[model samples]
Target: MYAFEYKRPASLAEAAQLLSGDDEAKLVAGGQTFIPTLKQRLAQPSTVIDLGAIGELAGIREEAGGVTIGAMTRHGQVASNDVVRRVIPSLAGMAEVIGDPQVRNLGTLGGSIANNDPAADYPGALLALQATIRTNKREIAADDFLTGMFDTALEADEIIKEVHFKKPDVGHYEKFRNPASRYAIVGAYVTRYGGTVRVAITGAGACAHRWSAAESALGGNFAADAVAGLTVDAGDLNSDIHASADYRAHLVKVMTQRAVKACA
Candidate 1:
């Protein structure tokens, strides 16, 4: 990694101040992606502000008729937290399979969502569950927070505080992951809130997005057969060596069907 000054702030205010003062500074939550990029010489920030020392940024709480997860909360904590498992077990399950132990233990929810990796698991969950992302500046809807691949709506000085997720009546996630990286090639998160059904898809496009057609069909009949005739457009999807756009589109339907069935 290129030489850079590192700061581990003890409080959120301090971190925000440091970030705002230095335009070339970068924030590190778990350093899962940023650290690797630094080592590869892809990013050379003058300062690396670490959020790990901010105790208030990490925790799991049950509130607001759902669950509020602190931004710096680690994947393994989310996966194993009793409150998370009880309130949104499917979300916990998604976290459980995000990556191998090392990644799971090191990656943070805030970093994952803020980075907005198309193949990341949390984006799909946030979109499907209708989450509210609370930052140091303002509250942004999950749909508005994730813009595109490796992008978010966060400002240069903004810091995510917590994510509040609406507890769905029923929810499940399924994915066809790349074996080596364990990143989703095509993943689907299905959720039903009373009569409204939401289907969020990931790893198939530039960003995680909802599958409206499937939601409409599933809202009418929450079953696998309801989506049997449904198909996702492959033109806009990612076509990497791991899977073609068409294949990922196909997996979208298959995974959605499987997730819905799992919810049942």
Candidate 2:
């Protein structure tokens, strides 16, 4: 990696200040994804601000209606937290299947959502459960947070503080993971809350997006058939050597069915 100034901020306010002042700066959380990119010369930030030293950005708190997870909470921590497991089992299940033991242990929730990789798993859960992203500057709804592949609404200076997810009565996340990296080839998160049903799909599109047609069909009747009947347009889906757009669309349907069945 190229030489860069490293700042270990003790508070979110300090981190934001450092980030705002450095035009060619980047946030380093778990370094699970960014480190590799830096080594490969794909990203060349002149300054790296590490958020690991910030004590306020790591924990799981159970609230009355849901749970709030600090952005720096590790994937392993989320997968194992009793409070998270009880409140959002599907989220825990999704965390359990992301990457391998090493990656899970090292990856942070903020890092995952901020990276917004096209094939990442967390975005689906965040969208389906109607999670809110709290940053140093402002709170953003999940839909508004994710803008595109490897993108987010976060400004260069903004830092994610935590994420709030509404507790669903029942929900499940299912994914057909890429064999090598364990990234989702196609993943679906299904959630049901007081007659409302939400279904979010990732890994197939340029960014994680809700399957509105399927959500509407299944909102009234929560069933595999309700989602299976609707067709997902493959016009903008990711297509590569591992899986074609058509195949990814098929997996989306299959995985959504599986997720709904699991929710049942």
Candidate 3:
């Protein structure tokens, strides 16, 4: 909203250089989140570096036992990609349900993961699938990459190149979203490989987190009924006009059940 210089660099190196040199500069991926923040005067960057012109940041590749998605890859592309559907259908399903058509077409994986929104779908999926976050500088495990609400381990000016998700033997994501915005009130992703099980819960706390209790319970039984007795604490959850923390906590259990069932 405020007057700011804009630069659409042809390569990642130029974009990084532009960002690193300016103390008050920001990177623009899809601008789904950043644009609104700027309009509200919540952020005022001296310069805006757009990564849209960089062609290398936009594709999907199938790996030996996983799928590697580029940073600028849109949700719509991921949702409809044959390789994604064949290798990790749950991730494809997650992308298909994100914020309707416009948002799907504009929102990028790197933007979503870098913003680290607690209610974002990709964070929970990354955690459950044990994905790797690849940056220009280094590759960070999903567990270590996300630190807190809207926070990541990425250094200043660091650009995420891609994200790699390992194929789970069985996986599914279930979300209870706010009707108006479609943001997850409480979302759960369940993944299983051999005897190991992993569960990630989002929108119920400060950040998307792995639900170890549910993982252990379902790892032993691999059934919806196995998690019926589990209770999520509301003590550290989000509470607002749409839903109370108590309600969100309740939904976490319900959605987790649904996700597990989908996997089964």
For 24-58, candidate 2 gives per-residue lDDT tens digits of 99999999999999999888888999999999999
- Candidate 2, after superposition: displacement of residue 108 in Å? 0.5
In angstroms, give how far residue 3 of model 1 lies from its true place: 0.6
| Candidate 3 residue lDDT tens string, 180-206 | 988898999999999999999988888
Residue pairs in steric clash, candidate 1?
none
**TM-scores for all predictions:** 0.99, 0.98, 0.98
| lDDT, candidate 1, 87-138, per-residue tens | 9999999999998888989899999998999999999999999999999889
Off by over 4 Å in 3: none
**Predicted structure 3, TM vs. truth:** 0.98
Off by over 4 Å in 1: none
Q: Give one clash count per candidate, in the order shown.
A: 0, 0, 0
Question: Which pairs of residues have clashing backbones in candidate 3?
Answer: none
Q: Which ten residues in a row have the lowest lDDT in candidate 2?
A: 227-236
Error of 3 at 199 (Å): 0.8
